[model samples]
Every structure is written in structure tokens, then in C-alpha cells.
Target: MSKSIDYGNMMHRAMRGLIAEVLEDVGANGLPGEHHFFITFDTRHPDVEMADWLFDRYPSEMTIVVQHWFDNLIVGSDGFQITLNFGDTPEPLAIPFDAIRTFVDPSVEFGLRFENQDGEEDDAEVVDLPDLDLAEALDLDKVEDPKPETASDDPAPAKDADVVSLDAFRKT
Candidate 1:
């Protein structure tokens, strides 16, 4: 029998490490410039800690925005803790790194998605992130459109922007 390398698991570890490093920096110096994050994690994870109300509301998975009003960000080797406002109610949550499903920073059009490979039934639904006007978010008057073929005299819509995928780096 031949042994095969587990590239998928390796990739997940590296991506999680990248997330950890970014959060660590943010925890130390605060969010720099206009960078913000939309982190989605599995609420059902055994290590996840949140208010009972929150658990009731988001029984499976929940997405939180780490933007202007977040506080008490503490990143650890296995997880992170943060306090986010829920309709003026401050709620602290502890999320293990392994529970994270997706992380996105629309300010710079960066995103990461982690898929389940353990053969467990993944009941998480596709989450639609709020559309962001990149020009307004970045305080830019005009942003160049990457697709010249579809270019028009009018400024390109933010939704028309291209998102680079990790698959691009994979060997065929």
C-alpha cells in the first residue's frame, strides 16, 4: 500500500495559522487603515462559548463582523475571544480556530473559506455577505476595473470586481 500526503489538511493548518497571525496583529495594534473582517464560525463546536440567547438565535453557525465596535480581542494558540455588540448588548464569545468556517476582508477583497472534509454532515448554509462599495470604503474616487473587455465609460460597480481564488495556486 502506498501512502499519500494530506495536502488538504496541511492547507487548512496553514490558512488557520495565517488567520491567527492576522488576528494577533490586530489585537496588538488594532485594525490598521480600513481593513475589517467578517468571520464565520460553527456555533455548535464544543469549545465555542457564547450567550445562551446567541446560541438560540444562531444554533448552527454564526458570522460576526470585526469592525469598528469590537473589543477585548485576545488571540490564543487554539482560539480567540472577542466581545461584539448585539443590538447594544455586549456579548463575549470564545471561538476555537478549528470552528472557523470563513474569514473575509472586503476592504481589500480578500477572503478564505474552509470546507469540511471529515465526512460529517455539514449543515451550514451559504451566507450572503453584505455588498460593500469598495470606493467608498477605501475613500477612493475611482477604482480601475480589472476586466477591460466589459469596461464602460462609467465607473465599474463594486460587484463586478474579480475575486482571486485559492484554486489558482493549486497544481492541475
Candidate 2:
């Protein structure tokens, strides 16, 4: 048998497309200049959580921010949530590990994406805050720094890379 499979590397490369999809959304709306995001997601995949008390809550991949008066912001591989200051009040939200859609820093042109994690295993594990803070996830300075924006005067943001073609993909 002379078959070798690099599933780990393959998964990483395949995931870049997913990340691109999320960034596309940011360019469309979130990019207003020097604005960033505090995206929280599930490291486990699939099993995302929200407040059981809210009726409007829907199980989806969501991304929040710390652009304004956000406090107690936390980031982990699985998911993230924070107390966004809306006017004079603050609310604490805890999102499931899998429900993160994307995190965009429009100030530069950098972002990342994640597919919803499947939370098949519900185990209690305390995650630690990494040394590299969320602010450095990619690089705000690189956000919205791409040159194509200057080339065209179109106000509308760029769209995500089409998956129908391999033109946007690269082999790992």
C-alpha cells in the first residue's frame, strides 16, 4: 500500500474558502473604516448555544463586535461573546462554540471564517485566554488595505470567491 493522505493539511486548505465567505460579508456591511469585530465560535463544531430565555434567539452562526463600548470580551477557538454597550445599558451574551460565522477587520483587509462546529459532545472544559489577543487575530492594519478598492470606484464591497470553480482554491 503506497497511499498517503494528508487530511490535516487538506482540512486547513479546504477551510480557507469558508473563511473567505465570511469575510465577503464583512466587506459588504461591516467595513466602515477602522472598525473591527469580536467573533466567537465553537471549537467543537455543530453544537452552538444561546440564551434559552430569549424567544427571538435562533441557532445560527453569528459574529459580534467590540467596536464601541464592548467590555468583558473573550475569544476562544470554539466560540466568543461579550457585553456590548448599547447606549447606556450593557448585556452579557454567551454564544455556543459552533455558531460563529465570521470576524472582519475592515480597517485593513484581513478576516477569518469558520464553519459551524458540530457539538456532539457536551463536556465541561475550561478554555484559557490565549496570549495573542483577539485584536491580533489577523491584523487590523491589513484590513481594507487591499488595492482593488482603490482601482475601482464602486461603493459596493467585493463578493466571496465562487466555489463552482477552482480558480479561487489552492492545493495544500
Candidate 3:
């Protein structure tokens, strides 16, 4: 069997490049007009460096707005550094591209979401199902048959081709 290339990961990295480019621009031109950003990142990521107190406050994740308050912005090849006020004290923050989860510019309603590869906050509830053949897998007698969707007294609206029915994969 041929191995499939991870195009999804490649695409994600490319999208991250967009954030880098925008940061570089802001670093140079100093955030032209109302083009600010709401950057959300995983604080648990190892490359993310910040003040101990700040990390303690935001133990899992944090969002920072890059507007009028930030200074000393440096956009590097792998990461970015910036200084922001934290309770009257200047706190320098270093955030790697890998730590970032979402970047948005509410000025234009543009945004991008990235997968957090650090394995942090994995709250997905996993349920294990028993292995069995299709016939033995289903308890047909215990399952009630689905009633047919009756035609309405008024003529039913046209069904859109884009609409999907999940009944095929349902246990019943």
C-alpha cells in the first residue's frame, strides 16, 4: 500500500507562515491603521516563555491583543518576541509558531485556526466499542424501526442537494 502524504500538516504550516508575515509587517510598519490581532496560544507549549506569574495565571491557554499597548515586537524565523504591560510591569513574551492556536483580525473578519501539536488539553472522551461482525454487532430486535417521515399536508419544500442524512451510519 502506498503511504499518503500529510498534506494537512503541510497546509497548516503554510497558513502559519501567513501569521509570521503579518507579524513581520507589524514589526516594521507598526500595525497600520486598525489592523490589530487577537492571537490565542497554548501556554503549556514548551517553547512559550513568559513571566512565572503570568504563566501561573494562564496555566493552559491565553489570548493577547496586539494593539496600542505592546512594544519591542520582534518577529523571528521560528518565533516572535514582544513586550506587554502586566499590572504596570513590562513582561517580555516569546511565543513559537507551533504554540499558536488561532490568529484573527477582527477589523476585516479574517482568521485562521491551527492544530495544537503539544498534546495539551486533550479532553476528548474516548469510548471503546466491542469488535464483532456486522450481523452480531447489531441488536436488531432491541432497536425500534425508524418511522418514515410523512409527507406534509402542504407540499414539502424542495430538498437541497447539499443536505446530508446521517441515518446510514446510525446503529439502528
| Top of the candidates by lDDT | 1
Give Cα distance to truth, residue 111, candidate 3, Å.
0.7
Model 3, residue 19: distance off in Å is 0.4
> How many clashing residue pairs, candidate 1?
0
Highest TM-score, which number? 1
- The list of candidate 2 runs beyond 4 A from truth reads 1-35, 38-49, 52-59, 76-78, 86-89, 116-172
Tens-place lDDT digits, model 3, residues 115-145: 4334543211111222323223223233222
Indicate whether candidate 2 or candidate 3 has the larger lDDT.
Answer: 3
For residues 49-146, what per-residue lDDT tens digits would candidate 2 score against the true structure?
34443213323323344353344445444434445432223556655433444444435544444432344322122122243343444343433222
lDDT of 3: 0.61
Off by over 4 Å in 3: 117-172
C-alpha lDDT score of every prediction, in listed order = 0.67, 0.38, 0.61
Ranking of all predicted structures according to lDDT, beginning with the best and ending with the worst: 1, 3, 2
For model 2, the local distance difference test gives 0.38
Each candidate's clash count: 0, 24, 0
Ranking 1 against 2 by TM-score, winner: 1
Taking all chains together, each candidate's TM-score versus the true structure is 0.69, 0.39, 0.65
